[model samples]
Target chain A: MTPQELRLACRDGSFTTNTSGYCAGYVQANLVILPKSWADEFFVFAQQNPKPCPIIGFSKTPGEPVIRVGGKDVDIRSDLPQYRVWRDGELAGEPADVSDVWQDDFVTFLIGCSFSFEEALLADGLEIRNITEQVNVPMFNTNIACEPTERFYGNQVVSMRPFKAADAIRMIQICSRFPNVHGAPVHLGDPSLIGIEDIQKPDYGDAVTVNEGELPVFTACGVTPQAVIKQAKPPVCITHSPGCMLVTDIPNSKLAIF
Target chain B: MTPQELRLACRDGSFTTNTSGYCAGYVQANLVILPKSWADEFFVFAQQNPKPCPIIGFSKTPGEPVIRVGGKDVDIRSDLPQYRVWRDGELAGEPADVSDVWQDDFVTFLIGCSFSFEEALLADGLEIRNITEQVNVPMFNTNIACEPTERFYGNQVVSMRPFKAADAIRMIQICSRFPNVHGAPVHLGDPSLIGIEDIQKPDYGDAVTVNEGELPVFTACGVTPQAVIKQAKPPVCITHSPGCMLVTDIPNSKLAIF
Candidate 1:
């Protein structure tokens, strides 16, 4: 479906599943809405940790309902398939829409997601195990500390995909073109170095098959910001449910720096 | 020294050692000279296997002694520090100068080398183990077969360097910018996957430290053409002695596409 159609379906309560594989050519973003008091610190955190939290679009003005930069007529409150509401870093509710809870002092940010890079990877004839296995990409919290800002501090969270050495090299080259979406891999080979205790056990998301002779390639993941938010414990924070991303009109190719 | 001065020094036998670290920012190329009879097939082989045999410049005419494309006044016979003369695919001699053996039908080719990319990696503060250890980069003959021509056929030869996963990713990025050199790495992680049996014992050059958390990254080596030429058994072939490259006036940065 087109991004507009997907957003419309979402608004009408007709589409409530994960947005993965929908609107294939358009960008799908990780939605993060915060009160104005915490937005500045979160923005600084993203700037300092670009790979995981590459901000593609943000509300130009606080309390504005529509996201003007990332897509035309993109309503921040109801465009996403699902929203996870948080109160003092605790899970409050998983809502289909959050328009009722919208605040005048709230700010919305659209961060780039791995889906775009995965599309590029698949287009290049490389196999992504998560897509093939029909599961979410495996994610782990690493000991690699992030450059922190006031009220925002945590270790990096990385997503893992397994590939043979040569394919991993090609993946690096391909992903390098899409920096906005966690460009290139941060680690590969030994999991111990990154504090990932077991390759088969992921801290978040479902673990996929890591075949023989394949190395687990890890990229800084968007979950990092959520992980940081939990640590920061803001009075209120809202994000898209896992895999339930905000579909945008912007073409995925537009994110490529090359 | 400037490339011109270096060439002059090579011509006069004032500098007779390997040219690995000399003329820091200039492009240093692997030299190959073959008779016009075998040049056509070798040229095709180079084109087919560009990562290993990236041809930066070649003689405009078969009998021309001076190379004008890659650098100025580069006399094919004496511009390199040392030359290896091969007869019927056998090593005939390693000579300081090949001016006396210059054949009218000799066609000279300057193939791109790893030195250019090494300079790039170093400039980015990444350590090159070979440069740090003051030794030649370890090279291995891989089972990864090369696309062959009628007169040339062999497996690829790759040079290995050890880097932590993060540095390896950065190295791939830096190398991708210089495709004229041996672009990005061919294989990384398990050495045996590429048919490299032992990481510690390389087929050519000295092995450097592969630190505890590091993986061995391999790049298609310029030596691949030399290995293929050996198998072809051309009546007469010549190449720059290992590490004794032909320094060019082209600045390394000029090769970066970005």
Candidate 2:
């Protein structure tokens, strides 16, 4: 569907499904809306650590749900196909819309997502195994530390995709151009060094095949900020339901800072 | 030594030592001066295969021995510390001055060398294992095919350096900015995948220690053109001796097309 059509469907509660394969050229973002009191600390956490929490858009004022970044008509509360409500940093439940529960003090943040660069890698003819297998990219909890804010503290979570040495080099070159979307990979080869034991079993998402000669390449996942928010235990937080992202009119090509 | 001082010393035959560590900030080049009869095919070879032979400077016309690229009063025949002569693809002899043998048909081509990116890697605080340990970077002949022209046909030769994962990423980022000097790496980790039997036994240059966590990163070397020239069997070819380079007045930063 077109960006406008998708937004309208999302607005009218007609198209409440994963936004992955839809809106081909546009940027779909990971949503993170929190109370103003908690938003400040989260902003600091993101600023201190950019790779894991790249902020593509944020509310200029609390309770101002009309995000100018996604487009003039893009409303954060209704645009995303689904949302996960968090009470005291614990996931309460995945909900279709949060506008009914939305408060005047809540702020929205549209963080950059990996789907943009995945499109680029695919265009370059490099295989993204998870997409081919029709599953979410296998993600892992790593031992790598993140610089903490007052309340936010957690280990970085990474998403893994396997490739041979040559393809991994090509992936690194392609991803380096999009710093907003987690930039280049954090680690490649020998998962054990990054504290990931059993490459087949992932902390989140479905496991994909890693062939005989492939090396597992890890990128900082968009799930990292949500992971951090849970660690901080902010009173209330709302994030996009997994794979149900905020599809912005912003073209994925715009995300390339080059 | 400064660029000017080093060139002056080389000109007077007072400094016959290798030019590797001298003239730190300036661009040092791989010199390949060939007879004009063979120049057209070689130019096509370099153009068709730019990653392996990124030409930074080429003479306006066949030999009148002076090259304006290096500075005022720079004589190509004598300014480099050492030169190797090749006849019919076989090593003829080593010569400090090729003035007597310099033919009007000789066309000089100065290809960008790794010195530019080595300085870049060092500036980014990534260790160049070969430089730190005071040894030449190990290079190997790879099975990776190169784009061929007429007589110039051979597999690409690659230079290897080891870095831990994080440093390797930084190296890629830095080198990506210098395409004229063989931008970015061709491969990293498990050299055997590139048909290199053992990292310990390099076909050229002394091998250095690759630490426990480090991976071998390979780049298309400036040595590739020389390897191709040897296979081409040009009646006569003149090249700078290994470790000896044609130092240009251009600063290393000037070579970054970005």
Best by DockQ: 1
Tens-digit lDDT track of model 2 for A20-99: 98989788889999899989888899988888999998998999989998885887888778889999878898878788
- Candidate 2 segments exceeding 4 Å error: none
Query: For model 1, how does the per-residue alpha-carbon lDDT over A149-228 read when each residue is reduced to its tens digit?
Result: 97899899999999988899999999999999999999998999999999889999999999989999999999999999
Candidate 1's TM-score reads: 0.98
DockQ of predicted model 1: 0.91
- The positional error of residue A58 in candidate 1, measured at the CA in angstroms, is 0.5
Q: DockQ numbers for every candidate?
A: 0.91, 0.70
Residue-level lDDT for A132 in candidate 1: 93
Docking class of 1: high
